[model samples]
Target: MRENTRIDWHARVEQALARVFASLDEPLAWQTLAGELHASPWHFHRCFRQLTGETVKQCLRRLRLERAAFQAAHGEARITDIALEAGFETLEAFLKAFRRAHGISPGGVRKLGAWAGTIAAPSNLHYAPGEPRKHFFIADKGDAHMDVKITTLSPLKLVCYRNFGEYWNLPGTWQKLFELMASQGVAMPAPTGMTVFHDHFDEVPMPDKRSDAAVYVPQDIELVEGLFRYETPGGLYAVKPHFGSCEEIGTTWDKWREEWLPTSGWQLDKTRPSLEWYQGHFDFAPPELHVTLLCDAVCRA
Candidate 1:
């Protein structure tokens, strides 16, 4: 892993705390846990703040509160009992934390009458791909047909590379493509399909493609040295043209999943990972340019 100024002791501490919180049935006191990590309470507290942006107690408290809400929303137990189980001494404290974490009160949760059915509701995984549907953003509906046209595309053959290791500090994979072309004697294009592929649920977002990114390349090009390859199997994509800083492209994803897909006569096709097509200048890439994001949708055959 490339060492950066950002690495600190508290990160390790936070990770340990997360593990402890998840397995809280067999609990350990602060000092005992501190001894296990071989750090003084004062030092651990300081490092926790520096790394997690929250104090140790607050971190544990927050995790407990989240657990309490989860349990209350799922377990067949009283709110007060669930609150105590999560380490909240008072129901009031649990209520406050619950509201903050879920944007709803404990009482509201009970009144909803179906904890198993609600509470951040589990996403449905379908056996087959979703159907294709056209979505458009009109500049002006008042304008004539000349102003707009819609086109459909068949499945695409997407060549890709998986990033691994400490990918954050490294330069964009675009450079890797340049080198790949040099070695293989193939021409490359200004990228039309560039995306960071997150295959699992990890909350903290990082620049390292090792954590994400299953980038696509031209079909004819051979895999270059130091780069691994894959294909985003051809499928229907609920393509959207998102123009923004690359870091902010996630907003488009949120909008798509929450606002659009839910009612758009289409369910997510999980076969191919979503693709991000760059839309702005390639001159000064990384941390500076705007881009487009496409949420790939595998269509029902």
Candidate 2:
């Protein structure tokens, strides 16, 4: 049974990869993925990363670059056109990535005959890829989702209003907490307010949307509300920054859980809570969200 399960899992990983390729333009949502393998999104993310040695998002980025390189080498399209076609919002960003990936400009590739005839495929990028990540997070299957990171954090106390009664009322719950915290001199950093879901969907029937978040503060400070004191333990966490709205943050986790973690030579230890630091002054508008997925080292029993 174990061997059979392994074989099935490998086949599913391939299918997931195929899906990623097929749905490049319009990314599929996590909820929609359940029918693909009869596994929850949480478990599927774990299994896919464990088997394929890369996460879905990491694979997507590579796919985009691969397409860009191919277009540069063969397509009649201009560099800007090729970059836009590959989902890069601007030519500058595309060129920056292209140079890093292939060690030459897209225009330079045409200047050299050597790049011709050779498939413009990406060389395997290991778990700790040479690529730059502004903001990102990785939480794999185990108790804690962190795999690797570099950070300097101080101990903190969080005063949170619990949402134990229902699951979906997360946005409102967060708003209420923020209001209370603001009244108590706890203001959130502007742009995107972060949400970290600790429990998987399967484990908890109605998952809270306002799951948990770190108080955005520049320096160590303490302020408490009545019965809402939550402590944020201080330590180092593997931090991956993403510059996008809150809605797009899941892709960061997908990349880490599926790609970075398995290959990272690190394990998940969820004893410590992860963090999210929003940039700018506190506001409701969707802003860039910086997420930190936390996991601690453990000695096996």
Candidate 3:
């Protein structure tokens, strides 16, 4: 059954790639690509990346520049016309991107009669003969049994306490936020709590990591001194229910990033923050706890 699932995923991804290449002259939409594979946009994105080693956006941009480079090297047509045909909005934008990728201007390429060879040639899933399959599977670490879905979330107004520092210190911040909320008389029946991570640890220093411990509350709730209101931007997310000790949740995230993400055809949506959705009570000690991790998946400009 696992093998069959893997095969189906690969076939669907290949089909989606074909569709994307067919319409290279136009703007590519995640929704359209997801629909083609009958998969969620986040899932499709991860899978595409896993199969191709490039995000959909990256693949499209590379293909366009390669086409433009070819024209610049071998054709006499005006650069503006070629840029427009390659889906660039303007000649200037095309030249900037081309120079960045190839280390040479279109005019330089034409005059020199050769491309700088810095930019790799465009490639598709169907490689030349003797090429090996790029996708591979990792040993399932029970996370494969976890259910994941791409969902659109409505904007949520949160009563929050912000924290800045190392991630391990977040628990203390949560305690402070909870105390502040209680003191402010901002209480909710069956309250849903979340911890929002605002910075990627890999991209930022430990001292710069920012997190917020928040709870959904009435929109009109007045803020107390240390507490403030935050509106989580509504967009698509990939959510997974986690059942484990809060401390072990980081392991699950690692599994997703190292094991699942590469093959999932999705990339982390860095524009928006990721959050930990608290479903119910969690005993920090032993056994395991049930919570949900909401990861940003929508790509925005």
- Give the number of the best model, judged by lDDT: 3
TM-score of 1: 0.38
Residue-pair clashes, model 2: 16
Residues 1-301, model 3: lDDT tens digits: 3678767876886676666666668888867889866788888887666655567787777767766776787779899998898788888898888777655678876875533222332122321123443332222324354467778888888878888875655667787877777776755322688888888548788688889988887546667788888888878887776654454456456656676566666777887888888776654432233456656554432
Q: Give the whole-model CA lDDT for all candidates, comma-separated.
A: 0.48, 0.52, 0.66
Question: For all the candidates, what are their Cα RMSDs to the real structure?
Answer: 19.9, 17.3, 18.1
Structure candidate 1, residue pairs in collision? 197-213
Per-residue lDDT tens digits for candidate 1, residues 1-301, read 1235235453455455555544544455556656767889776665555444455455555546545555655568888888878777798987787765544677665554433211110111001113221111112111121111122444445544455543321234555655665576654553554654544123424433342333444556666556555544544566765443342345345645665555556665554455555664554563223346455554543
Error at 33, model 2, angstroms:
28
Candidate 2: Cα lDDT at 216? 40
Residue 294 CA error for candidate 3 (Å)?
A: 3.8
Instruction: Report the CA-based lDDT of candidate 3 relative to the real structure.
Output: 0.66
Cα deviation at 232, candidate 1, in Å, is 3.5
Better candidate number, 1 or 3, judged by lDDT: 3
